[model samples]
Target: MADKRYTTEFFLTAAEVNSQREMPLSRLVTTIIDTATAHANKLGIGFDRMISEGISWVLSRLTIDIAESPSVNRTYRMTTWIENVNRLFSDRNFEMTDAETGRIVIRAHSTWMAVNMSTRRPGDLTPIWKGFDMVDGAPSGIDNGGKLLPLSGSDFEMSYRFAVSDIDVNRHVTTRRYIDLITDLWPLETYDSMRISRFEVAFKHEARYGETATASRMAHAESPETATAQIAVADTPCCIARLHFSER
Candidate 1:
């Protein structure tokens, strides 16, 4: 039987770094996502298999906590595994550690479901999943942060028109694009002084190319260092997120 957990070692590059030369939170997400895909493929439950069955995987919820982010030119090893599985969803967790120091840099948890493309509804996982060899370990620190509340108000909004480049194989806006839009809310100074400690997002709807959308952010009153944000198209929210920051 194949190993239940998967690990990948890679070096951070300029393309994956932010203005401060550290891994951007979005890239941290992309790293885990890529590793997850590779693992799923190895387990025979990946995009290729699902698409052949007229379905594809969709992210339901995500939570990430960063202790320290690897800077450009650093090598890191990331491990990911299935934390749990059910007919409707798969729970995944990830931990990234500095390859040289063996220090944990980040931890993340995510939920995903196979969805019928035509109907945009969840498809039964039993037929395809075939069960997992659940890793013998703990999951990420943060839980799969569930559905976030609607934004109370927009301190300010950034407008976007999904373009040809924003579309993916599904012919709709990709989750990465949503991350880009949300991450764009803060200025470079924000990144210089503060780092995202915990980040959570819920993917709610599908937005296609050529659609106009609004990205809004509001500071949380209870947690002055945190912010809640959303991306809505035609007043219909497609993605909502909460971000907690800590001084660097």
Candidate 2:
């Protein structure tokens, strides 16, 4: 039997870090997705298996809470496991820890669905998940299936054209690119002033290459630490996200 959990190790490199030499939010989120993909593949329920059946994994929602962002050249470890699964959606959890000090760098939860390639509809998860082990009841900071907070009073807006490089194997805009686009709305000085501590996003629709999209964001009324943003194409929301910050 395969282990119910999976882990991988890596060090922050130039490619994953920003100008300040800290790992960017998008890179950290990419780590979460990468670990999930590797584990899913190990369980025989990942991309290769799903794609063969005319299905692909679609990220529905994700929430990442970071305690600290590892600096360049620092080794870290990431572990992930299946928390729960239903016919329509699966919940996965992850933890990132400093390899030297054993301190946690991040904890995240994600929701994914098996989508039919042609129909663009969610497919049943039961058939392939029949014998998979789920490590239910583990501590997860973010709950699956919660309502995504809407972006209100987003007075800032930027129009963008989806570039060819942003397209992925799914023939749609890569999710990571959307994250970078949203993060770009803030000036570099803002990132220097505040550190993103938590981020949550809900995927609503797909944006394709050559499509034009608008990114909008605003600070929440309650505190300077909170923010909300939305990405849309033709005025239809493609994805929405909220980021929580903490002063350095």
Candidate 3:
């Protein structure tokens, strides 16, 4: 049987690290998304091929759990595979491990949908399901079905202007950019003292370049270390995320 998994190795560079010398969560997310796309391209069903056929893949949801964060110059390996494909969505899983110690640093799950670019509607994925090598289980112990409940009210609010560089080939703000914007709301001191244990996000609408959007965050009432955030363009909600943190 053909191997259903694809693995890639990476060495964290100075550019990818934060002031604390550890890999930033936002940059790690970018690596994960890029690696997944590269693997799909190798399988002959990536963005370029799908866009040429008038369809494109859109990320709907993502969940990541981190056990440890690798520091600058640290080498790690990431393995990704398709867990399953349904009529509307597909589940992709990832595992990132420390190359030296073989310890799991992060595990993530994501849901994606195939959309008809012209009609701006979701396309049936059954026809292309055969092209993917689907595995039987998820690499991350957590499932991708968790929902991000709406925030009661925002503790902080700010405006964001989308730049040209923020847009992706799909003509919308990139997923990694959105995460960077959300995480930026917190002070650097928070990151210095607290580490994110779990993170979840749901993409609701597309934000185009040159658009001004508002971002808001609300801390959980019971768990002070947990918070939820939402980014919206005018009145239209673009994305929502929940973050869980632990003191270092």
- TM-scores, all candidates, are 0.94, 0.94, 0.93
Model 1: lDDT equals: 0.86
The C-alpha lDDT values of all candidates are 0.86, 0.84, 0.84
Pairs in steric clash, model 1: none
Q: Can you write out model 3's per-residue Cα lDDT over 1-248, one digit (the tens) per residue?
A: 44578999989899878887998778878788888888778777788778777778888888988889778898999999888778888888899999999999899998889998899899777666565555656556875546776565799999999998999876889877788889888999999998888888888999999999998899989998999989889887799999999888
Prediction 2 TM-score vs. true: 0.94
Our model 1 lands, by Cα RMSD against the true structure, at 1.7
Model 3 off-target regions past 4 Å?
131-133, 143-145
* Candidate 3 backbone clash number: 0
RMSD per model, one decimal = 1.7, 1.7, 1.8
Output the better candidate (2/3) by TM-score: 2
| Candidate 1 TM-score, C-alpha based | 0.94
Can you give the lDDT of residue 65 in candidate 1?
A: 82
